[model samples]
Target: MSASCPISRDSESIKKLVDNNIGGVVAKTISITPALVPRPSIAIVDRGLGRFYVLNTVKPGEIRVESTDHLNVRFIYSILNAESWSDISFEHYLEREYPIAIKYCRENNVRFFASIGYKPEELSILGPRVEKIGVDAIEFSTHYIGRDYKPIVDSAKALRESVSIPIFAKISPFTPNISELVRELEKIGVDGIVATNTIGPALSIDVETGLPILGGSYGYGWMSGPALKPLSLAIVAEIARNTKLPVIGVGGIVRGVDVIEYFMVGASAVQLCSIALIEGPGVFKRILSEVEYWLKTHGYSSILDIKGISLKYLKPEPRRTWSTPPVVDEKKCIGCGFCQQVCVYDAVKIDLIGNKRIASIDQTKCYGCGLCTTICPTRAIRFLEQDLFI
Candidate 1:
């Protein structure tokens, strides 16, 4: 579970996660003084199937809305929220939340991690206190802190000196020179890394009301969900490649295959937020089932069997040769014209073969831009290029 997720908001919600077989829970982030969360804080950007937008050139800088009935053309899932840290005070968590969480987790054999944040002084004060509660670990976030490494390094040092328990730094994606930062944290005795928090100081507006939806200072919030996967995955891979410490992948994990992907890329574990909020607690059980089935069918006995497998194959340079064009599999082609629609080179065409329509490619016209191969709903188009660099 992730900080700021409703499921991690309270002890009761955390129990739901544990009962659903979640390995561990990170309590919502708290600071010495309670944070002021904005009203109408969260808004879901679920632009479901067949919706697309176009830039209206006639009125420069204006966006025009468009729609279609295509079944396979759904957009990504995203959410914008002005959610701040835990509304409850740090003292309240220390006096009430931590003790209860520690007891419950001990009884259930689950690990409890307390997430705390803010300046070095605040972290120095909170660290020893949370450790006294017998938390399995302490995760401090770098949410409002600037991207500069000095402040973070200082905070990590302070927290490290304040407690003897394992400490994890929840990092923001905006931090530059991640490898260098990771090295510094490792030197300072930080035990592990949480590769991401959320991706931005992003904004969302309501065209109807001509005002921002969220009530934060600028209605800005960090982005999370399916769209955040690519960036977060890259960060996880980079961190895992550079450090010996465990990396917990966060952001945009919605399915069992996603967990497999994280493991393959070197993540020791993962955290879920948006999906849990959208689908509720049962998602944990459902995804775990999916992971089990996938592992069994794939001939893998455990997640450890595939961990860090992709790191060995990483290449630093781009391919230099032109590869073969895509090949069409007649059995898989539905002739939906999607390939033809997306092909900029006019290399694909639909032809009536027997009673069915099928897609065919003109090798002469294809520049191997690969638009059709990706757009084909049935994966009918494919490339057989083996080792382009070779």
Candidate 2:
């Protein structure tokens, strides 16, 4: 959440923002009366595009785990790390808002999931409320998953005992060791796990002002966008490798190829945040369409076919096999001596042959990692994989 966003001060604007997000939730989850898009296969967020074109393009998937804002005064105050929520009546506003969203999803025939998040201490109070709301599923998330995460685990276990619906947990990605935490959630039978919540307390600055761009209690705020893709991918990949929990991949996913990459690493599905905010809802159409195109071209029919397929290729270290060395094509070499300077294995040697300065590779010393091939300005080096495999 951006500090300068309208939700901080404007009630109408905040409500409207919430409503749009609800609409996106609906469009993504269920049918809109006349049909919002071509096939209703992709998720078009209500708040992001506010139009039919955007909502119509979501990729077809199941009713995702959803977590609603913990709308109490303290909750709002704390999430933004604001001074207080004195301006908004927590109960009156949420009562007025949540039902309307529920009604919309119900009428639209969408299987909606309601989610809630707050400090772990507030779990007992919110647990009953989560049970009361009539949603298809429940998702529990919190910003506090640091060194002491026992509270989060306890809260999920408590919710599991009472809530009849399928449950999901959204854990923070910042934790150093999440494997054991995931193991505990799996032990208690969490339906799935959203490998992360937004990562931050990150800061973005204006070079001219030498100040932060977002507003918050501190200048720091959470970060979302393609920049987060690597972090999200690592979390999801780690969990997939170690546990059975179904993972919903998120972070910096901006294209159809990214979605496929998430699948290759072992995400059952992916969540869109930055892309939806950046490109609007229409991005779904482009992504899903391209995903379909890629599937067909690759001789695969479903995204599931490629899920975790790349895990087989994952290795802790690169193979150190001796293979063909990068041979400098003397005719093509510009004699820049870039390869000589870059060769970590001390392989490249530049020699003055007759009148011309020429470059050559010492095949004996070249381990075939091929770093020199990429550095060669004249395309004189070839880093072929077949030679490395040999």
Candidate 3:
């Protein structure tokens, strides 16, 4: 069992001790190596109520991890990182370059996370090795295949036993009961939870070709964009409400405002998968600056001041109430009358307002169902809800 490339002579004795207490009947084995240098470490651990901290020392790995105390974290999947690389180069990347990149993150103090697919053993081998090689944290992202989630639960437990580094499990919104999963993760000793990963065997196709735009054999690729904000936010809010484990919210986070939205729902930190690819890392600084400005202007000391403030408003069910109808902004409106066409209630009428023809919505006739707003091509329709009580 010790034959797989021991890091040092002491590793053999360490393996002997670890073997006595097997972490279940796990398939993979990791050769844990002693850290050459003892450095300051920080872990994004759950401090209850879904809050987290970058603490000075973590006891799990015993050897302090060299990481920044900052709560900000970034994630990249090996599949995404290796998409276009040649096999030899990809192998080299898996063996050395990727670990080197993780080392860079550790040295620079950026929280490092590498997300894995369904396989648990991948974490088992890489977790301790990276801890030894110098990455601070690891994340597990899995999609639930069937009703049975035992494999997912077992994988996390196996990794927990195999490595001492903080494990942040990314919750899939597709799961029937995310709160239940959160509790299971808590029991398995997951250091924290990442509120989401992308959903779907979804497809985006060319109109002319009737084939996927993703440009591969498969017609569908994983779908994620600004469209995912609501779904991801719901998961973050649900997990935050149900469990005390800290959440790293993700999905469709294109702006700093989006980050605040996640934090307000109790995400301790966050990750952006798709937007970072589109806008690049410069977005991080821009977001932090925007959040800082917004918080300071509002008399909050820092971003932390606003975190989870919205949790109180997240109810088990949305309040039942009547909303006001959509209003048309004449300045930006093209006077297409698309909204008027779609208004089933006949609440809209076209009129020559000044020189332009515009759609007018009658508040008395409008039920505030807001269907006309959705069909507006000119985006002239504005949907304003009356005050909560109104």
Q: Sort all candidates by TM-score, best to worst.
A: 1, 3, 2
> Highest lDDT: which candidate?
1
Over 101-214, each residue of candidate 3 has an lDDT whose tens digit, in order, gives 444444444444444434566557656655565445656644445666666687788778877878777556676677887799899899888766556555544569784555
Model 1: how far residue 312 lies from native, Å: 2.7
Worst 10 residues of 3 by lDDT: 1-10
CA deviation > 4 Å runs, candidate 3 = 1-95, 215-217, 321-361, 370-386
lDDT of each: 0.82, 0.59, 0.56
For candidate 1, the C-alpha RMSD (Å) to the true structure equals: 7.5
lDDT tens digits, residue span 307-354, model 2: 999777677776565566766777766566768888889988899998
Better of 1 and 2 by TM-score: 1
Q: For every candidate structure, what is the RMSD over all alpha carbons to the true structure, in angstroms?
A: 7.5, 13.4, 15.6
lDDT of 1 by residue, 124-230 (tens): 99999889878889998765556577877888999999999999988887787899999999999999999788877888888899788778888887788988888
Backbone clash count, each prediction separately: 0, 13, 1
